[model samples]
Target: MTYLDKFPTATLLVIALTLGLAPFVPEPHIWEKIKMLLAGTLARPVDIFDLLFHGFPWILLALKLTRQATRPN
Candidate 1:
């Protein structure tokens, strides 16, 4: 079967939680935070792309779980 055939709700929920929490979590490294700020200021498009790609894996995982949960006996 496909990825969706595998943890649907949990996968979706975890991803949702992480994404929601990301903004609130302060960067531990000063340099990393600076880089993130600069990237947001300069390469805005890249940041959007990064967000999309980052969610992909989670979506796939969710789909897999949905598939598995619905799998036939």
Candidate 2:
């Protein structure tokens, strides 16, 4: 998305590392959410929001990287 383009790669990386993978103790929150997701236990609204919240940065970063790579030089 163009919104992602507004943020520099460094910015997105920082957000991804921080917000995307927060609560690092006892493993990251995202990791737990992922496990819950796979186990079909992520039915709660809060859990869904948590997954989306922690996963946004990584998704944006991936989209940005994919776009950059596919762009014609």
Candidate 3:
């Protein structure tokens, strides 16, 4: 197993905490940028970077989980 498979729990926890709870904090910048993106208003370079910074980990975790689920036992 590679590093990703070895740390599935950690990845899941990060996904849950970041995407689930982080947005509730005062002035959640990443969440705001995501909303702007969905509303077709995200254009600033820093906002784009913030989106990628917070989003890439979730995407990778999702991909890892999907791969693990699809793998034959």
If the candidates were sorted by their lDDT against the true structure, best first, what order would they fall in?
Answer: 2, 3, 1
Clash pairs, candidate 1, are 3-64, 4-63, 4-64, 4-67, 5-67, 5-68, 6-64, 6-65, 7-65, 8-65
* lDDT of every model, 2 decimals: 0.55, 0.93, 0.74
Q: Best TM-score goes to which candidate?
A: 2
User: Which should have the higher lDDT, number 2 or number 3?
Assistant: 2
- What is the Cα-based lDDT of residue 72 in candidate 3? 90
lDDT of 2 by residue, 1-73 (tens): 7776687999899999999989999899999999999999999999999999999999999999998899789
lDDT of 1 by residue, 1-73 (tens): 5434444567666765665335544642323434676676535676556555555655666666666678787
Residue pairs whose backbone atoms clash in candidate 2: none
Error of model 3, residue 20, in angstroms? 8.5
* Local error of candidate 2 at residue 65 (angstroms): 0.4
Poorly placed runs, candidate 2 (over 4 Å)? none
